[model samples]
Each structure stands twice: as C-alpha cells, then as structure tokens.
Target chain A: MREKIIEKILESGMEFVSGEELSKQLGVSRAAIWKHIKALREEGYNIESVNRKGYRLAERPSDLLASNNICHELDTDIIGKKVISFETIDSTNDYAKQIATNENEGTTIVSEEQTSGRGRLGRHWHSKSHEGIWMSIILKPNIVPYKAPFITLIAGASIAKALNTLGVNTKIKWPNDVIVNGKKICGILTELSAEIERINYVVLGIGINVKTMEFSSEIENIATSLYKEGYNLSRVDVVKAIIKEFETLYFDYIHKNSKLETLKVCRNYSAIIGKKIYILQGEDRELVKCIDINEDGNLIVEKDNGSIKEIVSGEVSIRGEKGYV
Target chain B: MREKIIEKILESGMEFVSGEELSKQLGVSRAAIWKHIKALREEGYNIESVNRKGYRLAERPSDLLASNNICHELDTDIIGKKVISFETIDSTNDYAKQIATNENEGTTIVSEEQTSGRGRLGRHWHSKSHEGIWMSIILKPNIVPYKAPFITLIAGASIAKALNTLGVNTKIKWPNDVIVNGKKICGILTELSAEIERINYVVLGIGINVKTMEFSSEIENIATSLYKEGYNLSRVDVVKAIIKEFETLYFDYIHKNSKLETLKVCRNYSAIIGKKIYILQGEDRELVKCIDINEDGNLIVEKDNGSIKEIVSGEVSIRGEKGYV
Candidate 1:
C-alpha cells in the first residue's frame, strides 16, 4: 500500500495529489495517505507539502535499490523474482548463502556497499558505497554438482555480453574475471553448497566497479572501474542487463544443455585466447600458448615442447600480468 | 587450565585431589579452584565432593563430546587436530561451515544431538540424543572443485574400514551411505563451498546411529543402529577411529594423489558391486547390473542389452532397496 502510494506520487511528477483524491483512488483513509507521505520524507525523499495541495514527490533516493526499480527494467523470469536490497551489508554472498536454503531459487540479495566484500582465492573486494553493484544471485539449478564449474563461465559470458551491449567493450579472462582494457572491472565468485550428488544452492557473487574513481594502493594497478575508464554508467542498468543476460544463458545451459551461446561469448570476448599466458600452480609458473576453450570449458593450450594438454581451472590458476603479455 | 584440572581428575580415576593440591598443580588460588570446579559441574560433569577428601571425578557425562576424549585415541597427524564439541546444535554441518574459514584444515565440529538433522535428498536424519555420532569434519585440501566428488567416496571408504576394524561388518552402499546388515547405519553428507577453481572448504558431515534403540516409523524400516544390530560400540571410540582412518585416506588422495587404498577398501566393502540395481533419477528408473568399482570410484554397470556404461554418482542415484537382489 505504501509503495503504491509512493509510486503514484512519483508518477504524478510536479503535480500534487490531494489527500481526498489519493484516498478515493487508493481506497484508503486520508490519514493513511498523510502517514505514507511523512514516512517517505523521513526516508530521504524530498516531498513538498501544502495545506490544500496535499503532497508532491520532489525527488527520490536514486541510490537506493528497490525491487520495483530493478524489476521494472528486468527482462528475466527467475533471476530477480525477489530482490532483497540492503543499504550496507557485510557480504551479499554470505547473506545469500544463509538464506538460500529457505528462499526460492532465483532470489537475489543486493547491497549498495559491502563492508567486508570477498573475492576468489580469499582476496579482498573493494565495494565503494553506492558506487558499485555488489550483489549475489541464488541459483538452484537442477544440474549435478560436477556440472557446476561451467556455470562460472556462464556468468562471465553474461557479464561480458551485458557490458558490451552498453557500449563498454569488456573481455572475459577465463574462467571468472571480466576485464576491460586489460584491467579487472568485474569479478565473479561462484560458491556452491552441495551434497555429493546434488546441488543444494549456488551463490553467484558478482562485484562490478561501476563508478568507483579510485582503488586502494595494492589493487590500483590491477583494478579499474567503468567511470575511471571514462564511462559513466548507472549501477542499476548494469545489474539489470547482467541479470537479463544471465537468465537466458543459464536456462540454455541448464534446460537445453547447450553451451554454444556461452562458448561463443567467451571466445569472442576472451582476453587470453590466442595470447601467451602463464599458468600458476603453487610456486610453479609455466608459460603456455592459449589455443581454444574446449567443449567442457577447459583451456586447451600447447606447451613450449609442442605438447597439448587441457588445463582445468580447478587444478591450476592462470595469471597473465601486463609485463608478461 | 580448567581442562587440565578436569583431565587430572579424570586420570586419577577413583582418587580425590585436595583443594590445596589442585591449587598448587593448577597454579591458582584455592578459591579459584573451587570456582572452576563449580563451573565444570554446571557443564554436566559429575564431580563428587567429600568434606576432607576433596573433589573426585565421579563420572564424565557421556553425551558431551569433549575434544580431549575425541583426541585421546586419535592417532593421525591431521583430521582432528582441533575439535569443537557441542552438546546440542541445529546441525553439525551448518556450524562447521560457519567456522570453516577461520579454523584450520583438519578442525572438526561434533554435537551430541542435532535438533534438525539432515541427510541426502533433504531427508530427515534421525539423531537421538546421546545415541549417535553427529559430527562434521572441515577439509581444506589443495584439490580443485571438480576432484571433490571423489572425496565423498574416500569418506565412505574410511568409515566402512573404520567400523569393520571394530567388528561391525559395515559396507558402503555407493557414494555416501554406509550400510550394516542390509540397512543404513551411517550417512556421509559432503558439502563444498568453493569457487570454479579452488575449494574454500569441504564440510564432511557423518552421522552414525551408535546406540539408538528406536527410530521413527518412517525411517525405522530403513535405518539401523550399531547397538540394535548387536554391536554396542562407544561413540567416542567410533569417532576417533573414523577420524584416524579418514586422515590417512585423505592425505593419500590429496598429497600423494593416490586413490588405490580408497578404491580397494570401497570395492572390498561395497554392498552392491555384483548385484542388480536400479538407478533413480527425477522420474526415471533404469535397472542395471553393477559390474565393478572403477579407478575413479564410479560404478561401471552393464545393461540388459549388454551395453556397458560408467555410472557417475553425481548424475543419477542408485536405489536397490528391499526384495531386490
């Protein structure tokens, strides 16, 4: 009821809705209309009020992520059916996992800022307040646990495609990092809680530096935001596009068992394919020629000795820094 | 210091230690010693106090899973280096995952009773108070997430071997269930929190019906306790042996990259290696003859048409229930 009233005020633009008129349209008491307007003003909403003119919504907190705002632009069916938005959180991934068992699949948790955001390999992710898209999508795909590693690729491909649609040329560095001009603009952390044979839930934690202008000293060289790269983009638009792209790719992979679309996106936006890359395993680093991404999403590369082997992501991590390239 | 005092009392058996003696041994004042004793008694430890004879450890509560008791007979270097014991918890698997990041690789969490015990396929596991081994082991192996499915087989093999050593005659029923006398006696629920590349932690939840005399009607036909099956094993002893056996097999698989011992134990103690079984998918069931346990712990089976195919545990579940050979 409150949201509907707010929506009405927002749609009214500069025109004021009289209390009697709002009550007649909404089928609520005039006191309820007055109460909702006061609450909206308390929530940082700019409302102009007059004795006879009633209420007019001056402005809204655009930084806040409401489900209506996200769903209004959403095109997917399941990815964002229910959005739990927070102004500040410890980590969206942690919160999603905590509630994944009880919540329906495709439920999502998003935050303006994550106080202790995390990345792959236990790295620290910097999520600037209201500047980056810090979100975790809960997926309960009816696929085996072993098939889950490919979902990471699906997420990467979706992210790359979504950003590309917005005229930001983003490349994917398999198997999870999304790069823009050789620097990481986005990272996907896919965490699974599964039994031996079945997947209970998968928490896909995605962090995109949309408008972050600066980063900490340690990651300044490796991390760059969309705004820093001279693209002023709305975090909400990035989120909506990613979710829209992700749902299509995810359904194709899960329902149809087709990796053609994902593979196409990965190969087209690949940052390392056909380039010389280094594979890091423990303290050992070996340079290998990137050939092609195999059907199973493993990296098939030819060693300097003219031998070819598929490098599984779980067995080894790839690190091709700027100097190496 | 408190644990040491309790240990001293436990080791003394029937002998009583004077307050002054306890204070001298613990390097605390007599008043502090008395306070500690009161706290220990409040934790359900039965301590007897005589006027001049001082405090004698009358009995140790059997329900509490003290780290000292679990580690007393522990022989392996890892797997149970640090034990977190709880009297009652929602679920050991849930709690283990909560603390897995900060704890060491081989840290363990054990509870006397799980209020809401869970099993494979989201079934309810009957965990009666003081009558079952409800525990979860945290493993941080340096293996990729794809190789983690085999870890479940390793856990099942270790548990079967451990119980066989105690003359329980337990057999593994593929993947995760440990059966005795044609009924399930233990279940291994392996949950992994991982990325596409590396595993953050694997929570191996093992539940053994140690001395349960009665079960709920729904599970009574399918579940059997060690005590009901005429093996009155001690829960602590079972826990220690399983951890010791698991440590050896886990290290062999992770460090040495050897699944030979695990495969040998699994094949030898398999419940359906040579039997006709039914594979249960969502709504499809197919009958196949189990031929052999392959090198990777997958079930190699032959259909009636003489077509041979390897059955991966993650793809479909096996269900060769009663009245089926």
Candidate 2:
C-alpha cells in the first residue's frame, strides 16, 4: 500500500495531490496516508507539503532501488515477481541465500552498496555506494544441476542484449564478464545451491558499474562503467530492462531447452569469439583461438596444436592475449 | 584433554588407573583430573570411582558420535579430519552449508537426530535419536559443478561397498539409494554450493538406518535398518568404513579424473542393472529396462520403444516393478 501510494505521488509529475484524494485513491484514512508518507521520507523519498494545497513528490532518488519503480517497468511473468532492496549489505548473494528456500522464484535482492562483495574464485568485487547495480536474483529453475552452467550464459546474453537496447554497447567475455570498449563493465557471478541431481536454488549475482567514474589504481586500466564510457542510463531503467530480458531468455532456455537463442545473442555480442585468447590454468597460460559456442554453452577453442577442445568454465580462468578484454 | 583422558581410561582394559598416575601422565594436577572425570560423567560416560583404587571406565554410551570415536577409527587422510557432533540439529546438511565456506574441506557435521531432516525433493527423512547416522560431510573438490551428480553415485557405491564388507550385503539402487533385502537401508543426499565453473563446497549428507527397529506406518514397509536386517553393526565402525571407502573413491575421481573405479563399485553392487523398472517422472511412469552402468554415472535404460537413452539421476526417479528391489 505504501509502495502504491508512493508510485501514485511520483506519477503525479510535480502536481499536488491532496491528502483526502490520496487517502481515497489508496482506500485508507488521511492519517494513514500521512504515516506512509513519513515512512517514505525516512527511506530518502522527498515529499513537499503545501499546507492545504496538497503533497508533491519533489524528488525520486536515483540510488533508491525501490520495488515500485522496478516493478512498474517489469513486463515478464517470472524473474522479478518480488524485489527486495537494501541500503547496504555484506553481499547480495549472501542475503539471497538466506531467503532462497522460502522466497519465490524470480525474487531479486538489490543493494546500494556491498561492504564485502565477492567475485568468482574468491576475488573481491568492488561495489561502492549508489554507483552500480549490485543485485542477486533467486531462481528455482527445474533443471539438472549440470545444466546450471548454461544459466550464466543466459544471464550474460540477457545483460548484453538489455544494455544494447539501451544504446550501451557491451559484450560478454565468454563465461561471465560483460565487456565494453575492451574493458569490463559488468561481472556475472552465478552461484548454485543444489542437490546432486536437483536444483534447490540459484542465486545469480550480477554487478554492473553504472555511474562509477573512478576505479582503483590496480583495476583502472581494465574496468569501465556506463557513465565512465559516456552512456548516461538510469539505474532503475537498466535494472528493469535486465530483469525483463533475463526473464524471457531464462524461461526460453528452461522450458524449451533451447540454447540456440541465448547462444545467438552471446555470439553476436561476444568480445572473444573470433579472437585469440590465453587460457589461464593455474600458472599455466596457453594461446588458443576462440571457436564457436556450440549448442551447449561451453567455450570451444582451437589449441596451438590445432586440436579443438571444449573448455568448461570454472575449471580455469581465461585472459585476453593482451589484457582483460 | 577430556576426550584424551576418556580414550586412555577406555584403553586401560578394565584396570583401574590411579588418579596420581593419570595426573602425572596427563601433565595435570589431581584436582584437574577429578574435574575432567566430572565433565565425562556429564557427557554420559559411565566411569566408576573406587575410593583408593582409582577410576575405571565401566561402560560407554552407544549414542556418542564423538569426534574421538570416529576419528580414531578413520583410515582416510581426508573426509573426517574434523568431526563435529551435535546432540540434535535442524538438519546436518543445512548446518554444514552454514559453515561450509569457513570450514575445511574434510569437516564433518553429525547429529544424533534431525528435528526436520530433509530428503531429496522436499521429502521428510525420519531421523530418530541415536537410531541412525545423520551426518553431512563438507567436500571441496576442484571439479566443475556439472560433475557433482556423479558424486552422489560415488557415495552410494561407497556405502554399499562398506556395508557389504561388514556383512550387511547392501546394493545401490540407481543413483543414491542403498538397499538391502529389497528395502532401503541408506539414502545419500549430495548438495553443492558452486559457481558455474567451480565448486565452493559439496555437502554429502548420508543417512543410514543403523539401529532403528521400528518406523512410522507410512515408511515401515519400505525402510529397513541394519539391526532390523539382523546385522547389529556399530555406528562408529560403519561411519569409519564409509568414510574410508568414500575418501579412496572420491580422490580417484578428483585427482585422476577417473570414473572407472566408482563405476566398477557401482556396477558390482548395483541392485537394478539388467532389470525391468519404471521411471517415475512427475505423474507419468514409463517402463524401461536398465541396461548398464556406463562410464558416466548416468543410468542407461532401454525404453519401451527399444531405444537406448541416458537418464540423468535427477530427471527421473526409478522404482522396481514389484517393490523397491
């Protein structure tokens, strides 16, 4: 009820809506409306009261990943049925696991900042306040655990496709990284909690640098963001678009068992498909020519010996021949 | 220190060791030895104290899944390096997952009873106090998440082989059930927390009906315990054997990437190979003949149409035509 009232006030577009009108529209007492408004104000929403004139929504903070805004833009059946937003969290992935069992599939947990964000293979993911999309989606797909690796590609394709639609040209780097202009703009960390044969739940932790202008000295040469790359996109819009695109692609892959569509999107917007890359296997690095992503979502590469091999993700990290492409 | 004192007293072979001797051997004062004896008494150890003759262990409780008892009998290098025993827990698998990230790979969590023990697909596992081995083993195998399903079969084969060595003569039913005399004696629930490419940890929850003499009416016909089947095996010995067998089989698959040993164990102690069975898929049951245990742990079955197909363990639940064979 509070979310709907806030949504109505924001949709009013600088026009005043009297307390009596809001109470009637929301089917609540005027005192109840005032209480909700006070709560929203405490949550960083700005509302102005002109005595008897009415209430006007003066500002909608860009950092607030309010469910009302994201749900208002969602158009899919699954993948965003429930949205949980946090001001700050240890990690969205960690929080998602806490609620994964009871929460419905397609539930999403987003945070403004991650104090101890995690990347693949024990790497630290930098998630500063109000500058990126640090979110985790709880998925309960009825697929075997072995089929879970492909879900990462599904997310990668959806993220790339969504960003492309918003005019931000991003490309997927094989398994999980989303690159832009030869630098990484996003990282997908697909975490699965499953029984041997069954999927208990999957937490898809996606981190995208939206408005971050500065990176640490160590990563400044390789990390890039939408705002840093000169694309001014709303975080809410980008989040909604990613969820919408992900719902469609994920369901297609789950229901139809069709990796073709996801593979098509991946190949069209891949940063390493036809390029020469180095496969990093625990202190061992070898150059391999990237081949096509087969029907399965594994990376097929031609080794220096001219032998074709399928490289499973998570077994080893892949680096670009020159740098983090 | 307390556990070591208990071990020494038990190993004294009915001879009463003087308190002064114990204090000197343990490098502690006689008062400290008396305090440790009181702690052991609180833990249900039956120790008899004779006024000048000293202290002797009269009887040890059968319900203790103590780390001292389990680790003393373990022959493996891993799997039981660290054992944590609880009097009662919600679920060992769930508890293991909570500590999986911080705990070492071979850490084991055992509970005397699970208040709400869980089986595959949300089934309730009946874990009466002190009647079974309700334990979860934390494993950090450097394998892709796709290979995790086979780990369940490795566990099943290990349990079957271990029990057979102890004269119980159990057989594995397809993926995870260990059956004896046409009834289930054990169930292996393998849970994994992993990324698409790497495994963070695998919780192998093994439940064996060790000394259970009775069951609820619903499962009474399908479930049988080691004691009920006339094999009065000690829980510690069974646990040690299973861990030893699993450590050998698990390392073979991990270090050598060899499934041959696991498959050999599975085929040798299989209950359903070359037998007619029904594959229970949702509400539909299809008749299929189990052909062979392939190199991979998947069940190769000939359907009614005479076409051979590989059925992943989680995709379908196989049951015997007449009963649980």
Candidate 3:
C-alpha cells in the first residue's frame, strides 16, 4: 500500500493528492500514509506539504546509494532483484566468493565499508562509508574455464563504457582498472569457478570511490575518487550505468558471432599506449617502451634489447619509468 | 612413552628390549608399555616378543600414508616436520590451501580419506578410505607468481620418481596427473597465493590410491591404484618420497636458476605431446596440434590455418579426433 501510494505520487509528478484518497486507495488510515511520507522524506526524497490536500514529492538527493530511495527507482528487473547491504566486512571480494557457489545469477552485493578490501597485486583499496562503491555481481556464464580471462577484459570495458555514459572520460588499464587523469578511479576484480569444460559462476567485484574525501598518504598520489575529481554523482546513477553496460557487453561477448567486440573497446580505451614503463617480468623489473596491445589482448612491450615481450594479464604492475606510483 | 618404546624397538634391530628397561627408559609402567605394544600390533606392526621381554619391530604394512609409524621413521629435519591428519574432507586441495595460510612452510596434511576429494577442474578423484595416499604439502617458496605454475611440474616428476622407488612404473601426464598403463594412478593439484614479485605460500595436494580396491566402475577404465598394480607399498613411503622429491625440486626452481629447465619437464611429461587436442579459446573450442610448449610454459598449439595459439595453464582437456573427452 505504501509502495502504491508512492508510485501514485511519482506518477502524478509530485502534485497534490488528497490524504483521504491515498488512505482509501491503499486501504490504510490517513495517519499511516502520513508516516510513510515522512519515512520517504528521511530517505532523501522531499515530500512536500499541502495541508489537507496531500503530500507532494519535491526533490531527490544527489547521491543515490542502495537505500529505499534508489531501490524503487531502478528500471531493470532481473539484475538486482534483491539488493543486500553490509556495513563493514574484511573483504567484499571474499564475501562475494563465499556466496557465489549457491546464489542465482545476477544476485547483487554491496557494502558500505570494507576493512581489508583489496585490488589486484594484493594492494589495499580504501572504501570509506558512502564515499565509494564496494560491490560484487554474480554471473553464471555457460562458458569453459579457459575462456575466463576474457571476461576480465569484458568487465574492464563495461566499466569504461559505464563511466563514459556518465559523461566521465576514463581510460582502461589493460585488464581491470579504470583511470581518470592518470590515476585509478575504479577496480574490477573478476573471480570465477569452473570445471574443465563448463563454468559454474563468476563474481565480478567492482569498487569505486564515488565521493573520495581522502586516501591514505601512501596512495594519495596514485588513487583518485569521483568526488575528488569534482563530482558528487549519485551512487545509484553509477550502479544503473554499470548494470546497463554489463548487460550489453556480456550479451555481445557470449551470444554474437563474437570476437568479443568489447575487446576492441578495451584496446581503444587503453591508457598504456606510447608510454615508457617498467614491465615487472621476474625479480628484475625490465624497462620497456609501450607499443600496442596485440590482437589476443597481450600488452606488447618493446624491451631495450630490441626484443618485444608480450604480457598477458597476470600480476602486472604498470608504472612510469622514473617516478613511483 | 609409546613413541620412545617404538624408537628403541626400531634401533634394537627387531630385538626384544626387556619390559623393565622399556618401562624405566620411557618413564611408563610395564603394563602401559604392554598396552602400547598391543596398539602398535593392531596398526599392522609385526612385533616379536618373549616372556618379560619388550616388543621388537619386524615389518610394517606398506600402506603409503602418513602416520605415527612412518612419520616417526622420517629422516628429514625440515619437510614433513609437522603433519595434520583428517579422516575425510571436501577436498585435500581445499584443505591444503587452508593449511598453507594456517601453519608455516614444510607442513604436510594427510587425509586417510577425502569424501569430496577433487582434481583440477573440480573433478571427483576417487579417494577410498585407507586405500589411497591423499595429502597436501604447504610450502613458502621464495619464487614469483609467474614461476608458481612450475611447481605443478616439479611435484609431478617427484611423484613419478617416488612411485618408481616403490617399484610402480608410473608415467607423468603433463600438467598434472600420474598415469600407469594408460590410466591415472595419481594427480597433483598445485595452488598458490602470491604478490607479483613474491609468493606468499603454495599448497601442493597429491592424491594417489595405494590399494587398487574400492574404485568405482565409472573410474575403473581410467584409473589404477598401487595395490591393484601389484605393489606391496605403504602410503607413508610414498609420502616420504614425494616430500623428499618436492624439497629437491623446490630448491632447484626457487634457489637455483632453472625455471626454463623445470618448465621443459612439463612438455616432456604431459600427454599433449604429438597429440591433437581441443584448446578452449574463449567462446570457441579450437582443434589444434600440440607443436611445442613455449618458454613461458604455455602450450603452443598450431591451428589449422597456420596461426598458433598459446594455451595458458587453464582448463586443458586433451582428446583424440572423436568428439569426446
């Protein structure tokens, strides 16, 4: 009844609706309708007063997190049916992996705080409350185990397109992170389970600092959040964009006569091109000039010995030749 | 006191140590020593005795498992220094992965049975209770993440040599399993946690059926155990050989400079050599011939159109021309 009451208000463009009509339509007391309107206001939805006429919806908050205000606003039906929220955890990645085995495909998990959230190469990712998006999406693709790495590339491109849709120009760093102004804004950690011939599921963990107030001194130079870049973009908007892009990329990669056109998107958005960098090959990090990403998505690096070393996605660390990142 | 009793018995060359001396040396009652001797006998230790004389060792049942019997007989000062025993578990590989994080290096986990024992690709490995040597070794090797795959090859060669020491002629099935008479006798599952430049730890799980009994009909055609192969072997002996060989291989691959030499061992031992196999490349399964393994330990499979595909260590299932496993 409360949902219908709000839906009617939203459908009416926040115009005044009689309290008696709301009560009669919802089969509830007028006082109950007033209480729900107050709750909606607390969720950052402005419910205007019109005395005896009714309540009018005025405005929504700038940041749309997974609160009651945003869940009702979602347009898609399947991807995020049950939105689970957490206050704090050791890792969103670890928690997502724990429940991935039994959950249905498209189940979504979000955490407000992560104590030991991590990125690739065992690096810590700062996830403060409401300042970042710590989330994982469960996907069970009917693919083989060997085809798993390509999904990482797809995830990177999906995030890149999502940011692009939001009018935020960002570059992809090969396999999974998104960089803006040469600093990392988002990280995609793709973990999967599979048999030799069939994949059971894949949990794509995406962590982004939407309203970055600060970063630890160690990473202050390398990490940049959306808020730090002069944006208080609603988390809800980012989530919707990400889901929409993932749906398109996943369909293209899995169903079409596919070379995974998403791979081309990644190469197009790659930020490592034409840069002098160090390719951490073994214990001895080799200096290499960035050339191009080969067709199979290997980062082709030309070394000093006139030898070209192509690096596929593993624990690769890209850095400027002289300065530390 | 029982351990001391067994030690004395072993050192005395199967001669019966007097019950009084055994009690005095072990600081136990004569009756207590007699109780232990009886327990040892129940565990398949052949004890020789006379009136008022303590037990003397004759022979041990070669079960090829880790137990107080042979763990007490081990000669190493480092590897297998500590052992944890489980009757059954989901997967020895899973259990071993936990052990690597729990204990220090050189720890060995032995399971008398693995109810849900698994090989690579989560395939069910038939580990009948007390019929097989199912265990995992935890090691903190000083190696990089890229070099981590080589550990699989090292453990494979070591197990093949260990089975040879027990007079079982087993061949290495490249990438993982050990085969006898064209059937899998043992399989090695190697998992690692690492940074780009350093490995945190590695858990190597080796599952082999000591007695060929209790194998299911489904696995009968493709699997063989030691006892059915007519080898009077003990699980403890196989564990010792594997641990000894692993330490040697770990030293060479980590301490010495032969990562290429170690990787070459994979091509030599794998079943893919001179065979046509299906390489699962993303969405399409390609029919390719195994030409050679490149220096990076990736399989160089030549596709029909003159292009070559480098198959990384993923879900690789080798098959003949027929559309079957």
> Which pairs clash (backbone N, Cα, C closer than 3 Å) in model 1?
none
Q: After superposition, how far is residue B100 of candidate 1 from its true place, in Å?
A: 2.9
Complex DockQ per candidate? 0.63, 0.70, 0.14
**Could you tell me the C-alpha RMSD of candidate 2 in Å?**
4.1
| Candidate 2 DockQ vs. native | 0.70
Better of 2 and 3 by DockQ: 2
RMSD of each: 4.4, 4.1, 6.2
Cα lDDT of candidate 2 equals 0.88
Off by over 4 Å in 1: A1-8, A11-15, A18-66, A319-325, B1-5, B11-15, B19-51, B55-66, B321-325
Model 1 lDDT tens row, A1-325: 7667867777787888888988999999999888987886765567788899878866655545655567765777899988987768999999998999999989989987899999987888888687789999999988888899899999999999999999998998877689887889988899998877789899999999888887889888878899989888767778888999999999999999999999999999998998888898889989899999989988999999999989887677787844422
Docking level of model 2: medium
Residue-level lDDT for A7 in candidate 2: 72
Against the unseen true structure, what C-alpha lDDT does each candidate score? 0.86, 0.88, 0.72
State the TM-score of the second chain for every model.
0.89, 0.88, 0.81
Residue lDDT tens for model 3, A39-115: 76775666788877777777655453543444555665456655666657888778876887788877778877889
Query: Where's the lowest-lDDT run of ten residues in candidate 2 chain A?
Result: A60-69
lDDT of 2 at B319: 86
Worst lDDT run of 10 residues, candidate 3 chain B, spans B316-325
Q: Tell me the deviation in Å of residue B106 in model 1.
A: 3.0
